[model samples]
Target chain A: MEAVLRCEGLVKRFDDRAAVDGVGFEIAAGETYGLLGPNGAGKTTTISMVCGLLKRDEGTVIVAGEPIDTSSVEERRAIGYVPQEIALYPDLTARENLRFFARLYGLSDRMDERVDEVLDVVGLTDRADDKAEEYSGGMQRRLNIGIGMLHEPDLLILDEPTVGVDPQSRNAILDSVAALGSLGMAVLYTTHYMEEAERLCDRIGIIDEGRIVAEGDRRELIGLIGEADTVTLQITGADGCAERVAAIEGVESAQLEGEELIIIAHNAGSLLSEILVVVRDAGATVKGVNVDEPDLEAVFLHLTGKALRD
Target chain B: MTTALLLARKDLVQRLRDRSFLILGIIAPFFVAYILSLVAGPVYDYGFSADYAISDETGSVGEGLAEGLVDSGFGAEVVGSEDAARALVDDGEASAAILIPAPSPVGDPPPIVVYGDLDDGTAVVVAESIAESIANQSDAVRVLITETGNPASVGAYLGQEPPVGWVQGDAGDKVLDGITYLSVGMAIFFLYFTVQASIINIVEERMNGTLQRLLMAPVGRGSILFGKTLSSSLTGLLSMVVLVVATTLVLGAAWGPVWGVALLSLAAVVNAMGLGALIGTYARNAEQASQFAGIVATVLAFIGGVFVPISTEPGLFDTLTRISPHRWLLDGFGANSGTGTVVDVLIPTLVVAGIGVLLGLLAFGRRSKLTGVV
Candidate 1:
């Protein structure tokens, strides 16, 4: 897939301190890339430079095969940036806000239809005429996201879109963003929520202290820490079940503790059926089964020497 | 430019929805002007009657002076003696007393004597004016008799008011009457806040984070700045138009020729927008901008003679008034009032607009700081 955005060697300095020093990343078409970091990890600064909102001290940004910078107004049409704050006019209605941004993006043709479509997508069609200030926090967040995707630019950038939203709205926003990837829209999302990144991102970049400390898919990242998935089985009669499960192929080890069998493997999910058959042959009836897969949180901690939330 | 227009349209819609334009631009100025008109009713009533006591020691000239006082709309009463006239003035029955001394034996006209009550300054001025007019007529008669060798033709020139027409000159020192001045002045004084409120919308957007979104749009920072300025200028212009029409209909203010008024109003609006932009450049947020704009507007209005005409004589305060855009606006309006042409206000309008342009340039030069752009 052709890359929708490619930025390299991005450096931004405020006086003597560098906010983003030599950061680089790329997102392909139909891919969702997440920049996972704690607060002040240079995520916003990187996004600002990518969106051409701030002047970069050094680097190059290429969007849709075109070089872009802070002064490149024409080239910016390919990019849509949603800042962390709700940047809509509070006094204007949701529809009006959408229309204003649409005009700003030069989407003059069929603007009303586009606005209505975005309102529907954000689940705000029912209250489109109401002022933004009158909406709930979640609704405002949805509207904020709605505006970012209103132009349907080649690349959509959302900077901590669900930072202050309720769980329900956050889920809705996540779902909305998850659906956009299926439409072949490249999305660049920044967040500290490990589960959000693990769930929605095709590839994740663990950024810390203005640098991409690690980047890979979930399994690839877990492989970096040499961590294995664990599968725990509760049995009614689990006599000698651990030894049988341990004898099975792909099962690294198994231990029996109070009618419970704990098995560890490189890929436990793939070996679950074979291990269950062996448990049945051992005359052990299974009561429950739980699998623990290593997630981005552990990877972030293993890589950065600190928790993701910290 | 199109993007700027679009942003300006959005701003105007927001302002209209909140009704800030209506409240600041129309209602407040009109309400204040109405209140001032009511409270300062007597100041606006230019028609007043003053009573004068006249003693004719020289029967010919004194009688002419008394007739002239009555003809000039003053109440004149003849008295038997100069002491009687003095008594009437002292007793507060008369505003002033005019006495023509007895003719000298040498045959030259004796110097006309006039006694005036110091308390009634208006009456004293009127009495002095009547005495002077009579003396001037006598002097003209004497000159005609000596030069032309004919006393008969001198009779035609006496007791006739000199021809006078209130033509507003290019100097721009002339002003409207009390009620009209108050109405126009209040509208313009409130215009600063109205326009500044719109300019401060930029700061408000920054505080609200919308400005960052605007900057992210595919528009130059200059476009955003121009958009904000366009909105402020349009709001200011609309406010002036509404106030002009409202005051004219409700308060009976005669704002002179249409073309001249329009030119001056456009200039004033531009001036207000320019100053507002300059103030906005230094303001970190809307509230701070509002405070700074208010202080500047109040100070300018005071020195510009919006509340009251500071002075008619040339002095320090009078010279200071020239520095204010409000003074130039008022001067333009005053020059344009009643039968005045555009030429009468051209200089003042240029000065006002020039100040606005200068301030606007200064603000534009600092656009990087204002918008945080490189």
Candidate 2:
């Protein structure tokens, strides 16, 4: 896959403080690459450098394979940035705000049409006539996102998009981000929420203390935790299903907790079907099933020997 | 969607929507005008002081002298004795005192003793005018020996001619023949000040997080800077328009031809706001920008002679005035009313614009560094 955004050896320092110290990453086309880190972990600083808002002290940020030089206007033109803060003018109505932004980008035709489409995507069509200041917190957040995508640039960078939003709005935003990924738009999504990263990102880079400590597919990161896989089954008709599950291929342990059976396996996927047969022979209804991998949180803790929040 | 037009539109709408803008744009200028009306016109207080006392015992001459001094606005009142008048002079209240000899002759010089005060500058003039008047009266009484001489025949001997010197609109001292340029220059001064404040929006926007939002738009810092400057220019121009009208009609000042002066005012507005943009970018907040603006505006006004003519030498102020936009505007006003030259007006216009462009570049260039708090 062609990498839409490529940053190498990016180092941004403020006086004596290294806000983003020697960081590097890339977001491929049609991928949601999350920059997962705690607060003050240089997530915002790194993103700012990539968006060309802050001149990096030392680095190379290439968007769509073209180098991003501050002297080059076209380089800036190809990038879209949704800041961590709400970026729209509150007093301006959504349509007016959109029109103003479109003009700023030097767009000529279809200004209204582009605004309508973004408003529709964020489900803010009904409230588009109102001033942005009058919108709910969630709606304002959505409008912030709307501004980011207005120009349809190759790389869309969102820095903590759902910071104070409600669950429904968060879900809507995450879903929109997923849709963007599917539409072949490269997205650089930064957040502290691990679940959001796990759910939406095709690849995840976990940053801490101004550095990307680890990055990979979900399982590859999970395997970095070195924890046993958890295989769970909701057996309906068997009395000794947990005992039978312990005897299946690759199963190392078993336990019965209430109506559920949990089998710990060294390699859980290899024995999952065999355990299902044993439960069926015992006449247990497999009403529900769950297979839990070692999550990114565990991987984070294993790599850093500390909780993600700490 | 041309960059300049787009920025101008955004700036226009934003400033129009601001309450502070409305106050500075409309209320503040008129308030200043109202205040100006209160203190406007020539400033003068005619005054006179006396150092003499005719004896109240005789009362008539004393009363006449007192009346003459009071009418000239030099506080004059009769004292009880010569000693009292002398005391008044010593105490600094009276600049001089005249002593009346007993049995004064009816048509003589009166042998009046004149005492003087050391510190008062006006005392000499008062004493001189009083002494001259007394001498003239004595001379007149002698001339009118009886009903022998007719007053018209005596008037021929006591003749006077009008003093000759330069006056503002007279044939000799008539450097400026009208109030047109002065009025236009005042209008430009205020219009420029208000418009300069309009560019304080950049600092306001940053403090309020509006700049952060603007940056997030695909708009970038350069565009935001341009937008703010455009708005400032428009408001400054609008203010000039209102000022020209207010000064011309309300204050009874003229600004020569309409079209040329209007264009001059418009260009001046752009230059003033361009400087305002530079100030706004460097200043941390609105208040700081305002403080800097005050000093800067005063300097610009001084250079331009908004308050007073910068120089008194012939062709000196007229030459140096080229450094200020106010001078350009004033010159344009003169040109239209057939008082000044295109060279005089146009040179200042270009100079003001050159300074404005330099300051504008400094402000906009600093903004790209992005140290503004989010």
Candidate 3:
């Protein structure tokens, strides 16, 4: 019943900039915990600490209920790492690379079988014999994940595993990750892409500025900014149409996307009247209107003014 | 497969894949071996062409010896007078002026007075040789004096015969035996170089991130390093065996018992590998490692008799070479010849093994630093 992977007060600083600061989170066995954040938001650094590739400045990492030590060759064995960068030897064929890693993990006898299994899972069975460098971006990413599965570890820690991958390859990777969860492997998936986090993770932890600002079920996180709603209007109004809407009560922020004046508000029912009054005073006509529910993207934008891509 | 062998095999394959390593490892040894044969023996001869104004003071015999030298072997000049001889030697027109004194019989037929600055080894050998030939002639005159059973007319000019009790342990074989040490020493020295090159590959792997991939694979860094050392040492030992056996069996040259010589060479390879790893670890990158390795290996090779014969090295310098792995390997190699034992072979082998492992451990510190050198 213990969390498959746990971090308490983990903080890693490089050059006086906190890459991971006092970050604490836990992912249960058979669950995919996504670390969602923008670039340089400490996701990779946090995962690096978890993988034992980098030491934390201050924190305690418990992998499968055992204390983590940088020197614990045993502790390292329990965690499977797919680094942000492709860490496999480019010169080695996928099968050969898998076998090499398998032997390193001390599983020499049945490596052929395991390599075949992972290659099939990653949809790379046909291309497993090709050198890794010759692989397309998506194939490389798939093979990168296949490397992690070679040992069939209990806890799989993938850091930005799908970055730079084509949509098809990325979708295939997400399916493989979901399959790992079904097999009871704990998954700590880190990515800045919101859709991937929303699709793959059971619980999402929103990390920004080296700290986990909020982490919970997707519905629960969206609930954090429940009052945030996007109201779009087809307004053929005067020059001050946006200004009038901006002054309306319950409207938190407003912006125009081409023909639509998208106003984010706390109350959709009352804000429509206030918006209509402002448009009439400006001698404008309000046409089609739409109100949308809040999403993870809305929640993130409210928490930090910067967009996810920023 | 055993863990170490599996790791070692993979390591060797990776190294072979590296184009630079493949070229250097396969080609460099043969290239060096070919060069050594060409440049091995004496390179320069100190013979002079001088104007001859011979007076032939000692009559036909002096003239006969001089003519015999010019015609058959030693390149010499027959000068007419002492002044001409002095001028020829002084004006840089000649390396020496052989001034044969009229035979002063009683002591040692007037010692051949061949004169020049004496620091040069080749010059010393040539001068001493000329003196010995002249004295041999004088001693013949002494023997004739005894045979005739008379107080000879030139008693004072007669030379004494060489002593009858000349001792021998190894002095008799010095000239001919140098070739033996040259072959053994060169083989030992090349193994040392190859070991350094092996370590450079390891350093290259580490710097290029290949080592990180290799290490992250369930294999420990220790296993990777151990594999490297084993393969590199094997490479060195194999080259020695090939060189030794090729020269001995195919070329009809002898290097001693195949087993003993092979064992000695093998031990030397391990020692070289350890030294190489230590140096490889010392540098942060392959280029730096190769540079440091090359310089250190060169000094060791030069000291170990890859170039100049060790016998000619200054006593202190020769003794200093004992600390080098090259020196120990050569010692073990030399011991393999001339009434060697299992203990003799074991001592050097043990030294190489012990020191190799020790240096390997010291080099392990570099690996420790690299875990987070970034």
lDDT of each: 0.79, 0.66, 0.66
Model 2 alpha-carbon miss at residue B364, Å: 5.5
- Inter-residue clash pairs, candidate 2: A87-B213, B48-B73, B48-B74, B51-B96, B51-B97, B52-B98
Question: What TM-scores do the predictions have?
Answer: 0.82, 0.68, 0.65
Computed on C-alphas against the true complex, the DockQ of each candidate is 0.64, 0.25, 0.21
Clashing pairs in 1: none
Query: What is candidate 1's DockQ?
Result: 0.64
Clashes (backbone N, CA, C under 3 Å), per candidate, total: 0, 6, 12
Model 2 lDDT tens row, A87-137: 777768888887777776666598888889988888889998898989888
Q: Which number leads on TM-score? A: 1
- Give residue A247's error in model 1 in angstroms: 3.9
The candidate maximizing lDDT is 1
**Candidate 3: tens digits of C-alpha lDDT, residues A1-310:** 7798889999988888888889999888899999999998999888767776677789988988777755556667777877666766676788988888887787778888988999998899888889888998888877878888778787898888887788887888788888989988899999888888888999999999999999998777887876566788887745767876787767887776676788888756567777877777888777888988666777789788778889
- List, residue by residue over B183-265, the lDDT tens digit for candidate 3: 56556666666667776776766664455555555455566666776778766766676677655553333466677777777
Q: Candidate 2's fnat?
A: 0.33
